[model samples]
Target: MAHLIFSEDEQRELREAARAEFPGNPALAYVLENLAAEGIDLDRGRDWEDLRVEAGLPERNAEAPEVA
Candidate 1:
């Protein structure tokens, strides 16, 4: 199989589409794994939050809350 390359804008669009269409589905995770395999660090910088909000998901804290 040939490897596919995506431009930054295309990547952003893909992320948005995946998140919006599969917010609660494993497909979203699949999309992100594929992107990671292509060297896109989705967890880096503000990409995570930006993508989630852009996809109409609620904003969430990056770090987990402390347990009592």
Candidate 2:
């Protein structure tokens, strides 16, 4: 499985910073390109709107039984 394993707090900060700074097309592209320059290859297919909605949520608080 090609699952992403981001540290929750770190990803939240990154997302928030991105939302704050990249409020337009070229700026957003620059941000993404800069991330890629640093070897952070994010999957484009991942729906960020969905991720943002869940970013404030704890991974353990889902309806599914917790995995240990």
Off by over 4 Å in 1: 30-33, 36-68
Give me the overall lDDT of model 1. 0.66
In Å, residue 35's CA in model 1 sits off its true spot by 3.2
lDDT per residue (tens digit) for residues 1-68 in model 1: 34466877777777777777777897666767478347554445466667877899755556856445
TM-score of each: 0.41, 0.32
For every candidate structure, what is the RMSD over all alpha carbons to the true structure, in angstroms?
Answer: 11.6, 13.6
Candidate 2, superposed: residue stretches over 4 Å from native? 1-5, 26-68
Error of 2 at 38 (Å): 13
lDDT of 2 at 16: 70
Which structure among the candidates has the greatest lDDT? 1
lDDT of candidates 1 onward, in order: 0.66, 0.59
